[model samples]
Target: MRLTGLPLILLAGALTIATVVATVRWWRRLPIRIAGLLVMEVLLVLEAGLIANRMARFYPSWQALGGTPEVAVVAATTAGRLDASIAAGEAIPWTPPGSGSWGLATTPLVVVPPDYLTCPDRRFPVVIVLTGVTPRPAEGVLSVVLAPTARTNAASLATVPAALSADFRVTDTYAVVAGPGPAQPGLHALRSFDEAVRELPPPLTAPHRLPS
Candidate 1:
């Protein structure tokens, strides 16, 4: 689910107001109100600190979050190219140049092709993991992405091998691109990529020609 910046900001504002109201309501009834407020403030501060830490740690990718919108290509590469697809919200197929076969990952993995001008020989499969806007206590969108495919129903772009191995069979080779919205957590996205790679089928033994 893609979440725009406006909704996130609004949600934050609402939460802040709710916290304030709750704090004020209990202030008159108990002496612990002071302690409660102090604790709440401390917790809020800590939460802010943690968010800051994550922002800094994920700066490279996070910076690309709301900036110039471009196609974020994530790809994977094996000795031989295998057919694959991404499932962020929908499945999109990708076939890298120069390979016998290719397969997509289980999650929404993108393919970053080698630049024809510079690194023409570079071909790698990539997975683009998107994060959601909603900041809640429960599991974040990133976490959901990284969660086991067997557990969640979010978008999943995976290779045929990975898909066949999965509880459900994927029917295409493409990247799953999700719109900007509330996501679980980015870590889940990474995890999904890793899982897809790990679960992909081993390379074929003989060369096979594509159907013309």
Candidate 2:
């Protein structure tokens, strides 16, 4: 849990008030009152020390909470590049560029058609899918959910399953919420799904292409 100064301050104030009220109520009971007060003091002291240690980093200012243009670009660039409705495999934590994207470990789940490597053009119909927040591979979902239907129609769809914050093994504190609020910097994150229509595989070059 993020220990911020405001919460600490509020907790300290509450504890102080509680201690005072308890002491006043038990003024005649010296031993009990003193012990209660001591316990409160210890809590306050521990809280203060923790806040002091994390003062510089925790409880960021309003300006710091606000999103900057550079951060927005980074998020947009790598938003859904992790895993989507395109491929299959165990996703690895990765970012195309730097750590600016979502400030969290992002992943790139890639899987092409079975014949992609040997196909003439190696240019598969890449479908970037954003599934419900199941925290599973998007490609797997497509294969199970749509494979039967796709086969019936002779359809070939690739999947790239990517999510903003889904590396539970990485960090428990990882989180992302898409909203207009300040906490969710990526307001228009769904645009990544739209933008993926034009996105080719990483190389976008000859190596991934098939031999003529």
Candidate 3:
């Protein structure tokens, strides 16, 4: 079941109600009553926590609560050219030119659009994806994915554009949004660039069409 949704909420409420009724019905039986009461208490607490989680969105899914890593780009360096990578729409590990100055630990992953090679002169807009936790090389493709720390700011991330420009054909315009973090600086960077970002994945908003 989903961690947050009406269905789960209804199920929890039903369980709580069942526990309450059972506890009351077994009141005369000491052991049965005690067991029912204990079960009821636990159910009530779980119901309350589920309700709060729904409201606050602290955990969007059971996997998130269980600390399971989200799908990430699996970086492979077998592709010899940008055309090869773009054609396959593969994710590649990139060290952002001078990422050391930015205080980044893991190398960022880059996924170029499948149509990248089709338009030689056309520069694509960049979408900087920032996750709450660092993603492993397990899944996904396309877009510039950055795993920044709490201390990550626009200044520290300034080299990103330069690095991407050197490695890929990208325009000055870009969009910044929290893929799923304190992405205030990213938004500010968007304004600084004075252009819109497109092709954002699910849970992230975008105005243009997603990459092909």
Q: Which candidate number has the best TM-score? A: 3
Query: Among these predicted structures, which one has the highest lDDT?
Result: 3
Q: Put down candidate 3 lDDT per residue, 88-119, tens digits, no spaces.
A: 35566776447777655467877666655555
Q: What are the candidates' C-alpha RMSDs?
A: 24.2, 20.8, 18.1
TM-score of each: 0.20, 0.24, 0.44
lDDT of 1 by residue, 61-144 (tens): 445455755444433322222323322222223322321132222333222222211222222222333332211211101111
How many pairs of residues collide in model 2? 18
Model 1: residues with Cα > 4 Å off, grouped in runs? 1-4, 31-212
Q: Model 3 compared with the native: what TM-score?
A: 0.44
| Candidate ranking (lDDT, best to worst) | 3, 2, 1
> Candidate 2 versus the native: TM-score?
0.24
How far off is residue 143 in model 1, in Å? 51
* Global CA lDDT computed for model 2: 0.36
* Local accuracy of candidate 2 as per-residue lDDT tens digits, 1-212: 34555676667768877887887788789796788778778877876765664676643544544643342221111112333433334333333332233222224333333432323222233343323122333221111111121122111221112222231111111112122322222212233332443333321212322324
Q: Can you rank all candidates by TM-score, best first?
A: 3, 2, 1
Which portions of model 3 miss their true places by more than 4 Å? 1-86, 132-142, 184-186, 189-212
Runs in model 2 lying further than 4 Å from the true structure: 58-212
